[model samples]
Target: MWSMLMRKFRRFPVFSLDKRQWMKNVIHQEVGKGKRVIMFYVDIVKLTEVENRYGDVIAKRVLHIFERILPHVSRQVFEIRGNILAIQKLWGDDFAIYVSFGGDVNEEDCRMLSIHFQEQAEKQLNRQVSFVNREELRVHIGYAAISGQDIVKEMYTSVKRAAHMAKYGITSETYTHVTQFHQVLAEENVTMNFMPIVHLPDGETLGWEALARGPEGSPFATPSMLFRYAEETDTVFRLEHICRKRALEQLRYVKPQQKLFINLDPRAIDDPFLLRGEVFARFEQYGLNPYNIVFEITERHAISNYAVFRKIIEEYRKKGYLIAVDDAGAGYSSLESITEIYPDFIKLDMSLIRNVDVDPIKQALLETIVQFAEKVGCKIIAEGIETGRELETLIEVGVTYGQGYFLGKPDKGMGHASGQAMNFLRTMQEKKASVREEPFLFTPAMSEILAKTITVEKHVKVRRVHEIFEQNQRIESVVVLEEGRPVGLVMRFALYQVLGGQYGIALYYERPVSQIMNANPLIVTKDDKLDEVARRAMTRDAYHLYDVVIITGVEGEYIGIVTVQSLLDKMASIKLEMASSANPLTGLPGNVQIERELNKRIKQQVSQMVIYCDLDRFKWFNDRYGFETGDQIIVRTANLLKEAVMRCGSGDDFIGHIGGDDFILITKAAGADELISFLLEAFPLFFADIYEKRGLGEGAILSMSMAGVCMIPGLYENVEAIAERAAYVKKRAKELPGTVFLDERDCAADETHQTQV
Candidate 1:
């Protein structure tokens, strides 16, 4: 049964074979073409021992199996780079294979390739042959880069010598790593840790990124060290599979709506088992949905042929498993990988996210990346967010999600951001979300007004709905259910169409209530914003518009309902409260709320700015121009303050009107000067606009002045102290020329000058 090639090889001795010489000449010719040839020299170790123990028959059979194994392994691993140029036996049980590349060998690439082929080859042979254990069946693997430049320099000749140098270049430490890594892969000595990737604004764990850890208390405990060993030993796929299996085992505990991110090597696509849908079976066995799985293709792995690789992963994408590119900003291949793969998520590098608050260049780069990610329909997940400032900056720059030691560390079980980090995110999130038309800081959801809704299964008789409605007059509506999800709505008035008629009760009472229920009633989630839910509810047609809005949890399990009556009442109440609290003219926060806001900011000990704005000639103009014209002027000043705050300050900034011609603005200390400068520059134009609007002659003049104080920690405990200081500064500011801004520096200079006098 031996193949013709095996029978032919037996006919000639090593020296008589013309193939070896022919291969060498072909390689030299390739080098002459200015291409680099990577030649791998492989031979079976202890071949004579196998012959001594099992006789020549078994030894020859082992040789045949290894020859078959070589080609298969080449197809799996070697095909990534290119096809093997030739395979020739140099001597008995000794062989060599050559592959050509377009460019010279990179030292790093060469090192990785050598370990990859050698370690992976030995593993494959032991697995296929099974004649000996992994240690017993050793394959001596060596490789060399033969290039035109090296040949011209006479640096490399005799493929055996060149290969020996490349092979022996590996240090002794690699042997220890190989031994340790082989043990780890064989025994699956690894554990998985889960870290939460949180939504930055709410700190919600959108998904858990699985991190692989080696045996505890070992040198390989860290992922970098453990994976390094795997790389040196050429067991990346084996190691990746073990980590993957362990992570998937936790899928039973993960919610169906939450995702579990698994690290994947691009080379994993070459696995025959994966191509045959083996992982899909694993997911089915775990009772986990593939929709909740995400495969992270690390940017560290270099893809040789993206055209082919792209087609391979299309199957996984079609199966509802999302893809993420990790360590995006740390590698050269990140942009290419993003463009080629168009992944669902992009995990930014730790280096780029660290200290991003202070680096304008990094901020600009990240902003651009965020925009690019948005354009490509991918969400950005910033990694290694260690500081509060970094978190705030990322949110400001519009990175949607993030994870780091500051947010949460990896844990044995799924975890969330710690309480401390949660408070930080909550405060910042509130501040950022503060720019809204609603009166409250956070929007109320449908749950706020969820009514006690009655429910009956769809198969129930219509008589049941009638009984529930009769038992409780306040239960205006009943939700028809199939399983736990709502299928239709039955209202008190809907009963009239059926039961109000003469034969309505006897004819329809015994049938399924689904027949009488409104098949397509309004249904909103419990967490939906109340305003949006109300908008949707009000838009319904006349008959069903007043019907209850069925509220459900995120998974569509029916929770309760919000009647149109209660929803409108809630909306009216919110409007009434807003009307009472907001200023009549400017519609900004009034005196009571401004005092409360300033006191709260003072107690928080945060660095901020309190700006007091006033008009110098306003009293004279108000007396000459009627109160109506003066009101217009006050409104114009309020508009000017809003423009400065909106253009320069953050969303968390506070603006208020203080009676006749005075106003207040609170913003962060960081941009206080810029905001003040913008107001001073624009205030003069606004002042002129007021006079021009009334058709007043050019002789009229109005002067505007603003006083700003930078409030650092312990600067003032109460709003009274801030008000008194700002009042004095405002008095000083009114003494200056038109449109002037005075800060702590100017106040200090005046006090110093007065003391010197």
Candidate 2:
């Protein structure tokens, strides 16, 4: 029959091999062509269970039956390998009969063909009498017609996913016959809506949570209904993809500082379609600060596979989008999720805060959750707050942030109910200012000038500056020069050695200048800035070997020593410089102080790391916890830093305040991680204890999240450049499930697997 068909159509396309191989190649090539190619991916339902129950021989026999029955129904086109049979039907099956009438088939025809194939295949399998299969056998079919390599790749993934859904359906006895992929697609109706989570206290609007509405105008508006249908119909992935795309689109319309919370299923992140770079491109086109968009991951479902999901989340987070563990404190592994994902914010489940004030158990639960959040560096956002009593109770419990209808409803447009947040910020700032007073930035040029010229003859006992040392015992070393040249250093050790040793008075009175005087004095120019001179002087190594850098003329004329005491005075002046520019919520300098420090650093040409530290949800914490508790949080954070510096950092590192909850740090790159780690470990201790003392249960503790960006030489235009990058990363960290994000020029430099002490 094959030879006759080939000879009669000699002028037409000819097959080079047997019917099966020829059909396989033809199908493979046809699917490869055109803007869109229909994909029909088929898999046996419960094949694993069938094989285990009936053995491999029975499975082979079933496959053999399929091989023999193909030719009777298929107008053999092509096949890929032995497993997949690609066929263009001329007759027998109704779907194949319809395919013969094709001139670029429409979607309606495609659907009909898919349905027709399932019906014919089922009937054919049922008729086979030789094998009385104990359990009815059916094929789960998935199909997608798409164009472009990207779409094709996505189609391939979707088809495989559809196959799994179909197989799962079959196992449930719901889908007994061959299932068409379009059946699943038909059930998905992508829609979007919004709900607002408002701030309490002053009743200001902060942001809206984007909600997913299933099917046009359906009563099943809750997210559960939408997702349940998706799981039932094998369309969850598609529905999630559509909703995410819509949420990103809606972000453009949201008010510029207000955040938009998008609820996401953990499974949604695993979708290959959503992971494309084009999705991010669309987000960027919407003018969204990915950081401002919060992804709410519900903890209701068991997260069995977190490795891949976590990788996807980390990538998205690095780009600036924030992750929120929603309905936390209610899920089985809520605390575990908090630790694993390190979310920027944990939204307390309504169940935990429903009646926190009256119920000590609920209060204790909330408090524990809040404390856990603090320990992990996550901020708490109380959800489902509906009454004034609840609000007052939350405030008393020291909840960091609150979100509920009682606070504000989610709206379609921007511009929140006013006067609340602004007034609150103003009041807080005033209080902050009252507590902190600015310090004077005393420059050496501005300090009282001391002028004296005392010449030392060749063998003279040069103890002439004993009075200077007596005035300042902090002075560690002094320089001795000869004819406009640095020749020796007079260290405290040298003076004490001579005074107590065997050669005591003999050396002090008779020793020549070269013989007794210590050679190789550290020297500096008169023009060297005070900070630079101070930095060198503070080093014990510099003091012992060559304490000071001698000031010189063009001809190397000896000037004076850059003593350690002078450096200490210089540091004190810089601190005063910082105090002058601060915002009082924190003793740290404000943005203005940052500018000055950056100016000084750039002018001095010193290697420094510009650390931008921001307290995550500090404003909300203040609002809920009262200004006093908030102040304590700030004070505790400052003390943690001071202690951290005392324990881990050398004197060379400079930690400055950038005001409120923001801070600045200038230090060697090597110290960045250590300092950050120390603060991270130490902060929770102080935060927890303060909250405990305030009777904020055990959970309402204060915590901080930070972004530490390394200053790349020439990459930074000014301090603002470093500050901006650091701030951006800190924002990103606050959005993550954790409290600290250290942006060391490149985030990758902070290895994910490596633990830092």
Candidate 3:
């Protein structure tokens, strides 16, 4: 067998009995022509044990089986050892094989051949050697390949080293005995994609988050596998370089204001030769601003050498690059990293935002983060807003920016930035204004719009005042109180653009709020009609009447702002409360209210079917997009869910948002399937444009797969549980490529177990 011959090749030279002189002459001539020679040294350690167990006869038969396949796999096995051929099999289960290759042959071929020989040898042995007691047979192939000019002994040593690697690979289970080792590398391929992060306030997309993917149909189909491959080959640095370059090249299509966020393994900072300039050069090639490329460094790995990392990060920052501490507050020393880096932005971890509305502890922590961000001149991006309730909580906590699936799912092309919601905001403001002749004016006695008056020391930062102004929007004007005396009022607009200007923080730091605060601003009594006060507010000059501040008592104390929009919103709320049955986000009545309405219809014996809605990868969106933008996404999606329900809704129809990104609708059961069909068709195209806008691609193609579960009364208990199950089924639907799923009625169909193609 080749295994026996390989060992002989390592320990002794082989010369043909009758043709030794001729073979030696040929070998010398080949060596003279500069060919490389690899001598394989194989030792069959199990041979003695095999002989002991099955006697020599059965062992010899197993060897004969190996001989049959020897020629079949000889070319590959021989070339893999650098063209070495087995001179002969030897005693004690040892053998010798020699392969030689000229300048024309690649060394890799010999490695491949060696792999094939081992696989065939193992398979042939396993199939034929029953009496040999397979476990007793162990063989090792050692080879050293070197240029003919090198001494044979040196060549032997080199080949032996390679054999060690092969032995290790086998023992460690890096490769199956029957599988070619080369195929392992061939199987792992890396793929990449991107997700958009849109800023809600201005509808300007902020950046794209580069996501890692792997080869389709390959076992290595996720970032984890790609990384594992890199680690295995010690080529992680090479892969990062490639990923960075590819992501930058793709950034050419992004909007100018938008940035490209690429994740960096912080451990890479210790790599002395990592080319930082090469990265910038790629950006230059694509004409992208260095400032627009933000590196999101995750803290999942411990940063062992802080001094080195700090130096490298500082060097990058000096070159107009921005740094963001991703997943802040998620792991060890997250806040410490933020403080150390003084990042331009802090991305709150999604876990902190999940179900935030119901968690008081979470709200307090978030508020603290916001306050700290204000002090440090860093913007806070809350990650993961998936429900209206959560959005409302974030808004109340003074968070201004966020992103999540609730905002918009990542797509392969262009998608819109909720065009309908923007238009709705503009339209509703006007519609409500025109409908009421008296503008639904509210007297102070009926409205509780009082504000708090704060006295600050003269050395307080103007930034602090601005922070207070931004957070409590109800404060129309601030009366700077110093030593119990009113020094001045701070105009809101003056502080607005200041934060974005040069020296903004310095100009406000350590300065009295009075320095920038207006003096003797207009004052109004709390007893005035709120709508009438809003009308008066429009006529005042910028300086003379900073903003009308209403005093709850006499002597012009501080109170909340009374605007026309607020009055209209308040009127709507009153109407909603009087109705006492609607969802706050989409203004639909509560389930109890809905049940009454539904029962009324059912009592009349009207047919109805319930449909559920759930956002797919909504969590991923929140993780990528901060919670602020996520809220906008949730609010918009809630409206869209309502719209979809209404489009198919009848007098017996109902819609609701089940806390987060879950929804339900009850309609005529006969037409319920039709509603699912309509939604399945419309949702993707409706949102694809937004993805394109964010530069994921030309026309955003969302991966928000959806599925609906038909209402089966006995299948679930109560309306809440029914809605929960339907939404759960919808989530399973979203796992597939398309956007729609309806739980099939066939007995053979199970929506939950559907596969994604």
TM agreement with the true structure for every prediction: 0.47, 0.44, 0.41
In lDDT terms, which candidate is top? 1
* Consecutive 10-residue window with the lowest summed lDDT within model 3: 437-446
lDDT of each: 0.75, 0.56, 0.56
Candidate 1: which stretches are off by over 4 Å?
1-173, 270-287, 433-757
Error of 1 at 535 (Å): 14
- Which candidate has the highest TM-score of all? 1
Off by over 4 Å in 3: 1-76, 79-82, 85-189, 270-282, 413-757
Give candidate 1's whole-model lDDT: 0.75
Summarize candidate 3's per-residue lDDT along 1-757 as a digit string, tens digits: 9999887555334444454454455556667878756555555446666667778887677666655544444554564435544454544444456667765665455545555666666666576666622573545654445444435444444444444545544434443321222233333334457665645444445677776665566544567766765565445555675567566667667654467777777866533322334554454455444556678777766677667778778665544457878888788789778867778778888899999999999999999998887666666677766665675577568665666666555555534345543453344334433332221111223235544554455457787887777788855555665554444555566555343444445544455554444433444666555445554543332122325353444554444444434545655664555356454554544555545443433343444566656666667667765775456566776555555554554533556545566665667767776667767777766655456555665333444444444544444445555456655666556666656665635212553346431
lDDT of 2 at 118: 53
